[model samples]
Structure formats: structure tokens, C-alpha cells
Target: MTLEAWAVAAVLYVFRTLVDDDIPLNAGCLEPLRIIVPEGSMLRPRYPAAVVAGNVETSQAITDALYGALGVMAASQGTMNNFTFGNARHQYYETIAGGSGAGVLRFGERGEALEGHDGADVVQTHMTNSRLTDPEVLEWRFPVLVESFEIRAGSGGAGRWRGGNGGRRRIRFLEPMTASIVSNRRRIAPHGLAGGAAGACGRNYVERANGERVELKPCDTVEMQPGDVFVIETPGGGGYGAP
Candidate 1:
């Protein structure tokens, strides 16, 4: 769904002079997204599917595709999409995010955030721009508890123009259940532009609901039991200029 949206938007932007009025596109213009669910899949519901998982995953894909098509920027850290569900009164939750790429502009250039914070723009390519869901909604719909959610500090790459920061998500399960996550930017650092610095990588940790200690990677899908906790450290954007 996201890809189609972007494709259509791209066509419009390129042919604006001929089709629509030639309007200078400013930052924060959300790229359109489109999706087609295969028959008999989770998305192929009689009515509307939950859409939370689809939103998260599709967002990542759209971001990646945008980068690939535009070719004006470098590769991003990766996608940060997660999913969690509970059944039989059991609860499970997972949260994750991706990293940003190096600035591809001039040596002393700055990235466009489109929206959000400043610094390196949070390029949402074909593989990004997803949604896990709302904590309140998840807790009411599922059997999980959202411990905390915020942007991880000092995670962005260091440079003259620092990279954008990723996010952090924490979830605690009340009963034994299952959880899963799909993310990247661990192996491939976000590409940089000119002399810009690369962005930070992503990380994942497992803290027991009882406060135990356990660490994991950005990409992993596992089963969770009662009193289990999960923490997701999203990737950051790259620097645009030299420090």
C-alpha cells in the first residue's frame, strides 16, 4: 500500500508542470502508501484486519522503496517494525525501530526531516514508516502492559550534523504468551553523503517482567512466558556535515 502511494506521488511530483500546478514540495509531505494482501492471509480478512502489523511492516517497505527510487540519499540503518499478540488470557508484546542513513548531500549540508525532530532527516524508505500500535489499545485488546515508550537518547551518529535518533519501546507481559520482531540496520550501517557521518545501529534487550536481564538483536521472533519483558532500541540517522 505504501509503495503504490509513493509511486503515484512521485509521478505527480515529476509531472507536476504538465498535470498539476508546479508546486515546490516542502518537508513533511507524507508519501502515500498502498498494499494488497494475498488471499487467505492474515490481511485478507472478511472485514478489516487488525492492520497494526501491516501498518508497521508496510511502512518500512515503503521507506526502503522511496530511497531506492529517489537515489538522492544513502542507505538507511534498517526497518524497525514489531508485532505481539496474546491468547487464552496470556499476554505478549514487542517493540522495535530502524536506523537512519548517512547524509548524501554536500559536506556541510543538512538532512530534511520531512517532520519530527531536526538533524539528519528520518528518511522513510520502502522498508520503513510502519506502526506497531497504541499501548492503550494493545493493553485493552491484548493481555500486555506497556512499561515505557520514548526516543532513545545519544543513539544518533556523531558528526558535524548528527543523525536523527531512533526510538525505544518497552512492553511487559502479564501471563505466558508469544512475541516477535523484525528489524535491521545492525550489519549495514546507514550510508553517508559527502563527508557526513553514519548513523547509529539498533539493539534489542529482554528484561523479565520480574526484572531479570536478557539481551537480544534487532531481528528475532521468540516465545515469551509470564513475567517477561522486551526492550527495543531503534536506529538513528546519519550526520550530514563533518564534526
Candidate 2:
């Protein structure tokens, strides 16, 4: 079998093992679903192609693509918002969750409005379900302080059904350290559907002790100094329908 097929099989196997066993734990469960991976594409990268982002970023893109193809709403913040920082002795890594896209509103048989579901807030979904680190644990283990963690208001797209909001996280360093960020949706916003507005784009930056602000790209690695502040504003999800 092709590499893509193998990967899908492995994913399905793990999923089956984790979920209920009501359905037979065999290949029959996958018989009904059709999966296609284009040759040399990101999903099926050719030899020597760097696939570091495939596990986190590309997988989210694939999920968004599938949802978009079904004319569902718009794309979510399609990144894992991976962040890592460390010194010579201590290292830390985290995956921050972003917003989820809103879907089209449903109607009843009598043409009456039904209960429309809103997108999820700052929470992980799909393939990446890792939990956030506790603030107390972080403070005890690393030379950093959690400045703030809160929902970013007015970040989701506007529509009949609004999308979920992203989150903002700020951290202050107690000592010099090195940091790296692997994320996406920095340049382009998550798209909306059916006349809905696009969601806000993500941002990564640093504030020096001298009050200097430096913007960072989607994938960046930088050296930081003591008293420097790192901030991450995750992207919001797109809206579904016209207002």
C-alpha cells in the first residue's frame, strides 16, 4: 500500500482502539470511506520533503479542506500554535488551541429557525488534543511567569452564527532563553462562507524590557533575553452564514 494509505490505516486503527468496541474492530469499518492522497502533494510528500509540519499543521489543513468541500462553513484556525522555549537546563513545549468555524444554521420542516450550534472556543479538536500546561506547573519548572491567558474578544468572524473566539497568552521570562514557534494563519485569515466575514489572523511578537516590540513570522526561532515578554494571539474561526 502507499504511504498515505498506510498512514490513514494507522490513524483509523488508533481511533478504533480508543473509541467504543460496538463496531467490529476490523478493516470493514474503513470499507465505506474513500481516501485519496495526491502524489507529491503535501499529504503525500515525495522523498526528501520536509514533513515536520505535516503532523500538526498539514493535518489541520486536510480537516478544513474536507469540511470546506462539503460546503460546511469556513475554515477554522488551521494551526496547532506550537510554542517551545528553553534554556540549558529546562525546556518547555505547548500547543495552544484556537477557534473553530461556525456551520450553517439549520431550519425545521415548518421553516422555523432551529437551535444553531456555535463553534468551540479555545479548545483542542481533531488530531491534536493535547492539554495546556498548568500555570503553577510552568512557574515551578521554568524560569518564566504566566502574564495572562484569556479569550480574545471580537476576534471571530461576524455572521448569522458567529464563529468561536481565539485566545491570547503572554509570558514573561525571568532569564535569557531560546524560543521557537511553529504556527500558521499569520498572513491569511480564516475564510468565511455565505457572506460571512473572515476571522482575524494570528500574531506572534515579543516585547523587550526596553519596550521594543518585534513582530514574528509564522515559523520563527529567536533568542530572548531576561525580562523579555513573549505573546501569542491565536487565530479565530470563520463564520458560517450571512447576517
Candidate 3:
């Protein structure tokens, strides 16, 4: 099916599962929602398109577009930061989490104006709710070593209500393997709203056994040898108001 069709189906399923009212799970629930997919667009790619990344990356873009159209909030980190590695023997895939966008400002109980609500930190939004693999489990299951995993400090935008921070993960290969990454928000930072500041852009890099360092594109596939380290720095959310 098309990316747009898949997204609509996933969303409708979630809505149907969440409603507690006597409404039945049927096509009628989707009547109030209008889904439009433009031809040749990212959400609706033409035939022969490589849509592997659309399931994770483009879904977040669709969420951002919907939020923008509704004037609900600023844009979040529009990526899922998918990473994969394997040899002929085994393969593993993972989706690293990023930050969500901030909501509009509101008044405090004391009658004082407050900044917008802060976005979620290092989480899967929209239709994705998958959790990160445990470091111990990942290390035991693959020919890799977890060097470090932590939040990227000060990566969030500066504003009255600051955005949530992204995550940083580094892994070292124990043996030669093939690696692939599918992600976004590398060139353009997450957008801000109401004069807020934009969030930091994400980065990906590889450290070779020979002490050479190379930056990877947002979407890329590469071959790796032993002692190679792969690092991913996810994007932070956009701030909601002026600082």
C-alpha cells in the first residue's frame, strides 16, 4: 500500500482502539477526518519509489504537517533515526527516539503568563510507540559494544519554554558488518513558534579503526570493520515561545 494509505490506516486503528464510547470499530469513525495525499509527494510517492524509510521518517513529517495546518504547535524533530546492522548470520534494526514539539502558551494559576508546555523528551510520537532496546540485551545479542548512551546536553532550543532534549548513542563494532541509517532533521532544524528559537540539528558519524572520522548523511548505508564506532545524535524539539 501507499505510505499515505498506511499512515491513515494506522491512525484510524489507534483511534478505534482508544475510544471508550459505544462507537463501533468501522469506517464510520473515519468519516469526520479527511486524509489527502498529494501525488508524487513524500507521503504519496510514485511507483518504484524506495519507501523503506517512509514508514518511520515520513510518518513524523505527516504529523508535523498536520500540526502546522491546525496551528497547534511548533514542529518537532521529524525523524525516527532508524539504524540497522547485520552480517550474513544475523540482522538487527532499531528506531532511536527524539523530542516532540512544544504546545502554545498558557496562564498560570497565579494569573501570571507562562511559557508553552514542554514537549516530551526522547520519545516515539504519533503511531510509533516502540521502546529502545536495553543496552545489556543489545550488547549480548549482537557483535557490538555500547560505548555510551545519554541525553544530548543543551541541544534543546532556548526559549521561555525550552524544548526537550534529544538522545546520544554510540556503539562500537566487534567485527566487520554492514550498517544502514534512515533519518531526517539533519539539514533543517526543528521549527519554532511565536518567535521561539529553533532546535539543534541532528548528526551522525563513524569512527574508523585507523582513527579516521567520517560524517554520514541523513540516509546512508555503509560497510564497517572491527573497532569501528557508530554515533548518532538525535534532534531536539522546537521551543514554544520567546525567551
Candidate with the greatest TM-score versus the true structure: 2
lDDT of 1 by residue, 140-241 (tens): 877667888776676666654566677777777766676666666655556544355666677777887567777766556666777788777677765544
User: Could you give candidate 3's per-residue lDDT for residues 1-243 as a string of tens digits?
Assistant: 668876787557545644667787778899987877788977778888777755677767766656655445667788989899999977999988777777655557874546458777777766567887899999898989999978887777666677778889899999989999988999999887766677789999999999999999999888989999999999988877788
Stretches of candidate 1 above 4 Å error?
A: 1-71, 88-127
Candidate 1 — worst ten consecutive residues by lDDT sum?
A: 113-122
lDDT of 1 at 100: 60
lDDT of 2 by residue, 111-192 (tens): 4435455567776756578998899999998999999999988888887778788899999999989999999999989887
As a TM-score, model 2 comes out at 0.86
RMSD of 1: 8.6
Q: Please list the C-alpha lDDT of all candidates, in the order they appear.
A: 0.55, 0.80, 0.79
**Whole-model lDDT, model 2:** 0.80
* Ranking 1 against 2 by TM-score, winner: 2
TM-score of each: 0.59, 0.86, 0.85
Q: What order do candidates take by lDDT, descending?
A: 2, 3, 1
Off by over 4 Å in 3: 7-26, 105-115
